[model samples]
Target: MVAREKLNQLKEKFGGAVQRADMPCNERLFVFVEASALKAVCQYLFRDLDARYVISIGMDDRPFSGKFMVAHDFAFDQDHLLCSVLTHLPADNPKVDSISDVVPAANWAEREIRDLVGIEPVGHRYLKRLVLPDGWPDGVHPLRKDFAWNQVPEGYDDTREFKFDEPPEGCTVVPFGPFHPTLDEPAHFRLYIEGEMVRGCEYRGFMVHRGIEKLAESVLTYNEIPMMAERICGICGCVHNVAYAQAVESAAAIKPPPRAEYIRTIMLEIERLHSHLLWVGLACHIVGFDTLFMQSWRIREPLMWIAEKISGNRKTYALCVIGGVRWDITAEVKGELRKVLDKLESEWTPVVAAVSKDKNIQKRTRGIGVADRALVKNAGLVGPVARSAGVNMDCRRDHPYAAYDRLDFDVITENGCDVWSRVLVRAKEVFESIKIIRQCLEKMEDGPLQLTIKDELPVGRIGLSSVEAPRGESHHFVITGENNRPRRWRVRAPTYQNLQAIPAMIKDQQLADMTISLGSIDPCFSCTDRMETIDLKSGATKVWTQEELLKLTRTKKT
Candidate 1:
């Protein structure tokens, strides 16, 4: 009913522009609008109706529909509705009005659409290549149906270099990474510094683009993608695994058993526990407080062990299938999980007490790397980043996927809107994750682990899923297709949006604060780089083919 109400509101304002609409369920709404009206409808939803901008997706639909498609997703959190606005463009020259001006959060997503799918976002200023390499040939969008997944453009030029922006007057440019000690992945940030204060930055990342989405659409099957999805981010693999599975299930109108939902929730929370603990430890380590860092990690070890006991791996759980989960929490594993959680809560309470009052840690983080409520809203930052700024949004509570609707837990919030606030928020959330897992253990009922599918999934159906990862909301968009794999699968990790706010967050801060400031978002560069290769000795560079890489991996194992 809420979805219908929102749809009615859109239809009332722009009758003919809203070409068609679908309400897959009470929680989801899909509206197909005229290509000309895409920006206006998005502006109305985002500015007037106050929907939260989620992500934008570009699709090459020429083979099936003889048209290109672009979709912009938004969330009506309080209304518990996820809505998508889609438009079809002419196949020959696919282009649509850009919504970046109105919805500032869509800036990178729009650029990504242009880079991967060749859908031009007309009137978009500052359109540089976002996802593709600097040397990638133009007019060769790999996401198109005709483009082979393994095909390299004929004019591929690895020797080409990226062009960065000029530094502000009186500011000196300083390169931060691609290999900084604080960063675990490869992301390069060129910071403009005036004395000790940071003026602005230019970020050039995606050094290891995995091309997982292309692989899913072109190669992997429906059930097989869950395994591959887990590798999207080393830290939040299960989050992706579950989110991908849920997206497919949603498109097909299939629901897993109640027990499976609980299992998913439990695994997700277990992941939260380890992730929060790891973040807190790393945050302390970044601030030069190794005592707390060591203590936090020592307390976190058992959670990993318990996770390994429940599933097979500590990090990549490989837990979800299309309709349900791969692993169930038996009574033995459930009891062990409870004991681990109990110990974690007890150990974490004292650390929180100590950190809350520690003047040194407070001095370092307080009022540093600040992202106020306005930045959170404008940039579409989610999870702890948004909550730290006093924006009361948690996908588990707001969107209510899996067993979240049946469970009870608090959505933590803080007003500091700084690195200190984020530390406190994540530290305190550990107890909440403990609470959620306990509830799952007690309330979980005995049922089948998966739903049985009798026939092929209906084609051309679109599904969107948002799972609250420890760092932020992990969103997945799936369009069902004929070959038992997705026609298109787009993953918008929280980092994709959260990292965009980095330049703003670190701006005007001391140069020394950059590491902690960037760390506060808990950015997973791999997730953003979802769209890799190499050479050695002779200094001759050659992009390794998948076959060569697999052979190397096999040789190493042998």
Candidate 2:
């Protein structure tokens, strides 16, 4: 009943117009609807059914189907259902009604599709450049099949600066970045400032949009993309790696061994531990509490050692392969891991207590950067950003992946809906990560680490996976193709959605507090710059150590 009940409802509502449908599992549905009725169906699914909008994907289906494809993904969190309503329009008239009005979270997605795939979203309120760089040529959609990954078309203009919308009445302009001290990546934000208060802001980002999806679609093999995916972000590299591997596994119907699942879980949680610590310390540093920042990094240094000992690296462990994990936890490493967890827990408990009660930290963060429940729904923000706002949605629990279904950690949420609550949520989640790793260790069973597949993966099979990254949910979609590559690979980084909510979060807030506000979301511009989905293969990487970062911070302050 869980499988077909909702699919039946969609069929019953749309009748003959609901052209075709497929169910990948009991919890996932793919329905093909007529392009003309897409907006109506989207409204029905989003408003009437109360489904949460996930992401929208546009593809050039002309090579195969002589039409353009649009997929609006949604998750029914309560029902444990993930659905994609796919519609195809004729190549000559590639236009579909926009559902941004009905589901506000779909706004950036709609514009993104328009930018990359050349499909127009009719009635879109602001169809500005969302993904492409400032000087990209018009009518040259990069995601189209004919466009080569390395091709720069004729008539390209590299110096055409983006003209942002006019400021509100009596508001002075304050440019934040296309380079910021707090951000490791570049994104330009023009703030409409009235004295010290911010009235509005316009974002012009995607400065580093790399054609990774095109690379995957054109070049890489099935098992080789996991390493590339890890390059999405230094912080949540494993999340993307795991998400990409799981997507391929889903498409090929491959289930890794139980021990491999446990190993994957361990690596993911290890990443969460380091990433949360990094975020908390940065949040403190942003609020002028550099002492805590240094202290947190001091406590976090050992995890790097533990990770290097296990995976031969401090970060980008390259732990994921197509069917299973690349590394295993040995008895000696398990002993060391247990000791590390013990020390992490003991050292972290007091710090959590101190931050929770500290007046300066509380005053600096408590009411700044608020994202209420309404904004969470409208912007599709995930992870700590949404959870702190009383939105109890965790991909590990709601849409279980890897060994998460076998784990018993709680999804930490708070009702404060501010930077303070976000701090509490992440700080508490470190313990939860510790608990999950401990459980994985205890439940370990000696077995093979990966599956042996005798045949190539089937062509044209579709797969999708969502992993809970430290910042939020990192989602990947894949369509298997010939030459051992994906036909279309789409990535929706959590930052893409969460960053869109920044304008709303900072509105009417003090200009002085904006950095902490942005820092609270743990914005990873490199992750957001992932223009399309690409499977990342595990490989060598260079990561910033705590000492290096500390020196950099001190240098900046001086």
Q: Please give, for residues 234-286, the per-residue lDDT of candidate 1 as tens digits.
A: 99999999999999999999999999999999999989888999999999999
The 10-residue segment with the lowest total lDDT in model 2: 533-542
| TM-scores of all candidate predictions against the true structure | 0.96, 0.94
Pairs clashing within candidate 1: 211-531
lDDT score of model 1? 0.92
Q: Which one wins on lDDT?
A: 1
Question: CA lDDT of each candidate?
Answer: 0.92, 0.88
Question: Candidate 1: minimum summed lDDT over ten consecutive residues — where?
Answer: 533-542
Model 1 stretches astray by more than 4 angstroms? 532-558
